[model samples]
Target: MKIFDLAAGADGPEPAVATCSRKACRSEASWQLLWNNPKIHTPERRKIWLACGEHRAWLEDYLQTRGLWKETLALVPDTSSAPIGQDF
Candidate 1:
């Protein structure tokens, strides 16, 4: 993964915000690990999917085996202003 240091005091456009890709899972906490895995994605880019608390483990395993597990960050969908869900 190409890790870049954000310029000092330079908060780039709040990051490319996205919603969970899963339809059955509605909780905003749903997120997938987006990173470079030689077995899956290219090392120079970021990839994402949706995973709720119930599917976190399974998703992690899937990504880990492909060697793409870089970081699991929490996300809040733009549909609501309030904290909609909790991360597991």
Candidate 2:
């Protein structure tokens, strides 16, 4: 099976996956923010943050203060259904 298929089938719940937009960061992300970037995404679309655990709290706080917390929370994927990997 293809990677996507395997990923889909071998999972309990789907975790949110996103890529960091930072120039120097290339980490695979599970947390993201729906930020709208006129330079890239359309005005109606929000961008993502793809934050690691270390940055999750910080990022959430920043977004919360901006009144974008609801939007940000909406992007969080449900982990309860995701499969636990051996790495954990």
Candidate 3:
């Protein structure tokens, strides 16, 4: 299990590939863990932690213990959005 820095995001360049939030796992993320630390963030604010199939349960358990887990959802790629381009 890798110690991942969630804020750092996937280890890559533009058009970033979403990877598991697990420290060192490079597997593509399959689930989105949406949560918020009520003590630090606003109620409406949500922080996302991506998880691959293998780490989903572990991550969820971690967050749930802290009472931060709000919801988990399948990570569906957004096809409607246009890819990043040089020309704006």
Candidate 4:
């Protein structure tokens, strides 16, 4: 439930702490929600929302309802070159 503010990412000194975007769950994030509103944002503009398995789908549905859901990506380790399944 602790959301990392992107404001700390713009020329700031702190690093982004990965956490679930769920309202009440403080679980670690396992997925990334890539979204943007074309009507008010550029095609290249992407906003990110991190979520755990239990909440990823719920968050995606919320964005889909508003036509803002672009893609859902699994959060994996950097050393692994394996691709995540796209069955979601």
Best by lDDT: 3
Better of 1 and 4 by lDDT: 4
Total backbone clashes of candidate 3, pairs 3 or more residues apart or in separate chains: 4
Candidate 3 clash pair list: 2-23, 2-24, 3-23, 4-23
* Steric overlap count per candidate: 0, 5, 4, 1
The top-ranked prediction according to TM-score is 3
Q: Over the stretch 16-76, how does candidate 2's per-residue lDDT look in tens digits?
A: 4454434455555565655553555556765556565556667668767765543544334
Model 2 TM-score is: 0.38
User: Tens-digit lDDT track for model 1 on 6-53?
Assistant: 442355324333444445666544565665657655677666665777
Candidate 2 yields a Cα-based lDDT of: 0.53
Cα lDDT computed for each candidate against the true fold: 0.58, 0.53, 0.79, 0.76
Q: Relative to the unseen true structure, what is the C-alpha lDDT of residue 70 in candidate 1, on a scale of 0 to 100?
A: 78
The digit string of per-residue lDDT tens for model 4 on 1-88 reads: 1234454465543433457887877787889999998998899988888899999999999999999999999986444433333222
What's the candidate order when arranged by decreasing TM-score? 3, 4, 1, 2
